[model samples]
Structure formats: structure tokens, C-alpha cells
Target chain A: MRDSLVAAAFELFLERGYEQTTVDDIVRTAGVGRRSFFRYFPSKEDVVFPDHEQSLADMTEFLAASADSDDPLVRVCEATRLVMRMYAANPTFSVQRYRLTREVTGLRTYELSVVWRYEKTLGDYLRTRYADRRDGTLRANVVAAAVVAAHNHTLRHWLRSGGEGDPLAEVDRALGFVRETLSPDAVPAGGGTAGEQEAEDVVVVITKRSTPMWRVVREVEASLGED
Target chain B: MRDSLVAAAFELFLERGYEQTTVDDIVRTAGVGRRSFFRYFPSKEDVVFPDHEQSLADMTEFLAASADSDDPLVRVCEATRLVMRMYAANPTFSVQRYRLTREVTGLRTYELSVVWRYEKTLGDYLRTRYADRRDGTLRANVVAAAVVAAHNHTLRHWLRSGGEGDPLAEVDRALGFVRETLSPDAVPAGGGTAGEQEAEDVVVVITKRSTPMWRVVREVEASLGED
Candidate 1:
């Protein structure tokens, strides 16, 4: 019934425009009681992005489950995945919701505002994890900010592209970037633990700004021969 | 005139309350006409976050000037510093503003929405830098997010502690973590080269989880001894 109401509302929004649509019009069009519309969605805009409260609750649950992990980077990654999975499972709805959000200024603000809830929740968890470290507070805040940033980046790309491909890979790679960025010590297992070695030891050799991949590889190989 | 309006607004907000204070009261206290108040500030809440628009403009200008640099990471770090400098130059005002933002829910949301503008601006510049590289968009977004995250983390810590210490050092360290995380291969001159040596000639040793620092040092010394 609620889904139908939301579907009806979006249909009306497409047909008549968001400005012309109202709660009464939505309920009337859906053939549902006014109380039912209010019960399911608090306002007309709420119907457009109804899953926020639920997804936030879902994110809260995932973070709570992972709360005991001391691995701040891993914990943040897991919390971030919760959001990605929600979109992956419902790509069509998410895509439509994305379109609506991008077009509506109020909806866009509301969407961005929802991100803060995740940041705060993650930040709180981070504060607990880093309480003993000298820079625990700052680390937690950074970690939280990075998680939200990484998640939003992936989510936005997937959204902007019309949800066409495997976003999980992009999401993992992005999170991998954040994880490595925050905790370089955890570089992939095969990368050999020069994790302790000063990161400065690794020098990147690129041919020129326009260097081709094969040439870049040959240059790297040639450079390696010198040592 | 704008400065006086802001100062007067803050003084009044502190003495009375945000809701209780009116435009009439603010202008009367600041010795400005009602028309002058409208000319300077759009609303009472607008006066609370005066530097937001200007700071965003300054950051955009800094990034625009850095577009010629091939190093995207350097451009982002410099941009982050510009933002921090804006805050550092106004510690007292920022501290007071922080207090007001915390107490007012509407101001908090407004402040957050404005901060997103900074994040989006930085993220967009990063996107342009990484436009050609496959899988680069996600990496760029994450890097941008991490940069902002690092800045916000440092800023929040300074604000939360009542602006007690030099936040620039903290911001630098946080951003350093971000740079290292995102582009470990691009380490400075002292960091090792990115070239890979012949597998047979380079016997790299990784430290065990339980290995002591002294033992790891001895192992490195022994390996060099063989060479």
C-alpha cells in the first residue's frame, strides 16, 4: 500500500510536476486514506526519499554489530558497505530516487543532511575506539569523515551514471584507498610488510605526462636495472 | 558595516537568544538602518556564518590557480590549507560561532550544508584532474573526501577544545596521512623509488606480527650484511 502511494506520488510528480503535487493530491490519487499517507510518509517530499530513516536504522545496526572491532579502518569499511548494499539490492528505486534528489533542491539538501547522521554515528564509534591513543579524537573524526566521503563518492558515481555497472568493485577500491590512506600499515598481504618502512622509500617513475602504459612499464623496468 | 552587523548579532545572540533577537533589535544595537541590515545580511541566521561564502570563493580561486600543476594531491593539500588559514585567522570568531552553532539546531544544519559546498568544490576539482585515468574517478573522490575529512577532523578538535592549541600542525599531520594513504608511490625524494628490482636480487624481508623493533632492525642489518 505504501509502495503504491510512493509510486502514485512519483507518477504525479512526473505528470503534474513536484510543485503542483500535494499531500491531499497524492493521497487522493492513490485512493488511500489521508491518515495512511501521513502514517507512511510524514510529508510530500518524504515519499520521494522514504528509505532514509530505514537505511539509517540499518546502518546503525551494522555499526553496532561491528562496534567491538579495534580495527578502525575495517570497522568503518563495514559500516560504509551497509549503505552500498542497500542501493545495490534496489538499483531501480535508488536510480529513480537519485534522479529525484538531483532535480529537487530541498530533496538534495535532505539527502546531504542524512549523510551527517552516518558521519556522527561513525565519529562516535571512532571516539570510543581511539580513546586511548594520543590523537584518538582527531583520528576518529578523520576516519568518520573519510568513510562518509568515500561512501558518498562511490554512491554518487554509481548514481550519476544511472546505476549501470558493478558499483561494489568501485566502492571496494575507493574504500581501499581510504583504508590505505588512513592506515598504510595494512597494505595488501602480498605487498610485503615494508609497511614499517617509511612510505618515502617508494618512488613513482612516470615517463612524461603523456606516457603510454607499456612505455611507463618499460621505463620502470629500466629504472629497476640501475640498482 | 557587515562586520559590525555580525558582531552585533553575535553579541545579541549571546546575551538574549537567537530566536528572541529580531532584525530591529540587531540594527538598533549596531546603529545601522533596517535597510542596511538587509543589504548586509539576508537573515539573522545568515549573520551567524559570515565567512562561509567568502571562504568558499577563496578556496575556488586557489584551486583554479593550481590547475596547471600535474600533482593533484599537492593542489588539494594547498586548498585544504587555505580553508584552515581562513579559520585560524579568526579563532575568536570561530570559537564563538562554534558555540552558537552547537546551541542552535537550525544553525548546525545550515553550517553543515555550507561545509558540503566546500567538499563538493574540492571533490569536483579532483574529478577533473583524474578524468582520463580509468577507475580514477573513485580514487579522486576518495582523495578529495579524505582531504576534507582531515581538515574537518582537525577543525572540530580545535573548536571542541575551545581553540586551545595550534590546529595547523594537527591539520598538516592529518593531511599528511591522507597523502600517504592515497598516493604512497608519490613519496618525496627521501622515500624509496617506485621501481621494482629483479625478484632474484632483491630479497625483501617482512616483519612478523610479534617481531620486536630491535629484531626487525637486526634482520635488516643482516640482510644488508649479505649484500
Candidate 2:
């Protein structure tokens, strides 16, 4: 019944325009009672984003259930991938909604609010993980925003391409950039091993050009020795 | 006239609640004609965010007038400070709007739209600067979001403290983290002189932990010799 209602609503939205399509119109087209349509969706706009609430809940659960990895940013990035998967699950429907959303200012605004909720979810989770760190709130907010921005960038590109190609691969590459660029561990600090060692270790050193090459070399050697 | 209208609207909004307040009541309270009220504000919600449009324009102009610094991200960060300045320019009103926005869902949603506009402005500027880069759009979006998130985090903290502390200083610290963490040049890449030589040149190198300390030393020595 819910699926039929969504189908009926999308058809009417496409045929008669979003503003012109009413609840009565959708129920009549679906051959369902008005109460049934209301049961499935509270309003016309709600039908446009049928899967968002479920997706958001799924994302929240995914983040909550994640292992306490040393790099919380990685967990946040993985959580966002779940959202991408939700869109990728129904490319045609997602594409249609994306196009429709562009035409309706209210839907666009609604979409932004939904995106903000996702960001808040991610930020709230990170805040708990980083509660002990100085500037944790700031870090959580920035990382959350970066993850969502990167995801939207890739998602919009995929949508614009008519949902062609591999969205997951594209999103992974974009998320990789965020992880590399904004990971807490990526910052320069004294070397300390906290998490399980990866196959490779990376050390980043920043120095002035005017400094002697020998001195820079010595600092690297010293840092590597500490590791 | 505009100030009086806004003042009247806010007073009524606070006393009678946002939903209960009407345009007619606002005009009556301000002792102004309905035409004057309409000329100043499109709706009751517009009165809550009186400075946003002007602040957005000011920010756009600030970005446009920025010197073509080699690191465009720095210029973008600087442009965001102009927004911080706008809020700091009037603390009492900013705090009142903040409180009212928190209480009203519509105003909160409207505020999110305003933030999106600001982010779009920043992202559009960055897209042009990074037009040739491989991940220009992704970088632009991520960096723009990061700047806004960091700014909001600090601004919210200031607001939650009842507008009591130094917001600009807090914002600077937050933006500094963003700049240090996400700047394009912050990544480890081969050194090359591009912009005006600063007082000091910085070199960053990343290498596998398994690499022999001696080998790591040699690579740095070798790279320094080329310069």
C-alpha cells in the first residue's frame, strides 16, 4: 500500500506538478482511501522523501554500533557510506526526487534540513568519542561537515550523470580525500602508537626552506628513531 | 523605519510567541503602515534575520576583493572572518535571534537556508580558484563546509554562554585548526616554489614506518640537494 501510494504520488507529481498534486489526487490515482494515503504519508512533501527517515535511522544505528576504532573519523566516513548506499539502492527513484527537489524551493529547503540532521547525527557521535580532547567539539563539527560535504559532492555528481557509473567507488574516493585531509591523527604531533599498526606507517614533518638540509634530515632521522 | 519594524516584531515575537505574532500586529506595534512593514520585510521570519542579506553581500565583496593569495583556502578562511565580524558587530541582537531561532522550528530552518547560502557563496568562490585541480569541486565543497561548521561551532558556544566571551578569538582558533588540517598545501607533496617566498619555506614528507631510518635520512638529504 505504501509503495503504491509513493508510486501514485510520484506519477501525479510528474504529471500534474508537485504543487498541483493533492492528497486526494494521489489517493484517487492509487485507488486507496484518503486515510490510507495519510497513514503512509503525512503530506505530499513527505512522499518525496519516503526512505530518508529509515536511512537516517539506519545511519544512526550504524554509527552507534561501530567498533571503537582509534580513528573515529574512519567510522564517521563509513557511516556516511550507508547513506550513499540508500540512494544507490533506487537510482531511478532517487534521480527523480533529485530533479523534483531542484524545481521546488520548499523541497530544496526540506532537503537541507535533512542534510543538517545527518551532519548533527555524525557530529554528536564524534563529540562523544572526542569528549576528552581539547577542541573536540570543533573537530567533531568540522569532520562531520567535511564528510557530508564530500558525500553530497559525489552524490550530486552521480545524480547529475543520471545515476550512471559506480557511485560507491566515487564516494569512496571522495571520502578518502576527507580522511586523508582531516583525520585527527593526520595532524603533526609527537609520534605515539595507540592503535593496531597498519601495514605502513606515515610520518609528516614540516620545516622552513631556509633551514639547513642537514638539520631537516637529522630531525627526520630522530623522529624515525623514536618510532 | 526598518529598525523600528524589526524591533517591534522581535518584541512581539518574544512576548506573544513567534507563531502567534502577525504582520498587522507588528505594524501596529511599530506605529507604521502595513506598506512600510511590507517594504522592509517580506514576512515575520524576515525580521528575525534582518542582517543576513547584507552580511552575505559583505562577505561576497570581501572574497571578491581579497588578494590572489597562492593558497586560496586562506583567502576563503579570511572571508569567513568577515561573517564573524558581522555577528560580532551587534552582539545583543545576534544573541536574541539565536535564542529565538532555537525556539522556533521555522526560524531554525530558515537559518539553515541562510547558512546554505553562505556556504554556496564560499563554495562558488573556491570552485573558481580550484577549477583546474582534479578534485576541485569536492575540495571546494568540503573546505567551504568546514569553514562554516567551525564558525558556527564557535558562534554557538559564544551564544550559549549568553554572548559573554570573545567570539572572534574562538573562531580564529577553530578556523586555524581547519586551515592547518585541510589546506591543500597542508598535504605532503614534493616541494616547489609557487607564491611569493615567505620568511621561511616549509617541507613536509611522508614515508613508511618500515623504511630504514638511514634511507629516510638519505631521501630528505637528496631532495634538499635538488633545491
Off by over 4 Å in 2: A189-203, A207-215, A222-227, B188-203, B207-227
Pick the DockQ winner.
Answer: 2
Residue A218, candidate 1: C-alpha displacement in angstroms: 31
Write the residue-wise lDDT of candidate 1 on A171-205 in tens digits. 88777666645553422222321223322223233
lDDT of 1 by residue, B104-136 (tens): 887887877888888888888888887876556
User: By summed lDDT, which 10 consecutive residues of candidate 1 chain A come out lowest?
Assistant: A186-195
Query: In order of the candidates, what TM-score does chain B achieve?
Result: 0.80, 0.85
The local distance difference test score of each candidate is 0.71, 0.82
Number of colliding residue pairs in model 2: 2
In candidate 1, which residue ranges exceed 4 Å CA deviation?
A32-35, A67-72, A132-134, A180-227, B67-71, B132-134, B186-227
Q: Model 1's CAPRI class?
A: acceptable
Q: With candidate 2 superimposed using the best TM-score fit, by how many Å does residue A41's alpha carbon deviate from the native? A: 2.3
Which 10-residue window in model 1 chain B sums to the lowest lDDT? B191-200
- The window of 10 residues in a row where model 2 chain A has the poorest summed lDDT is A191-200
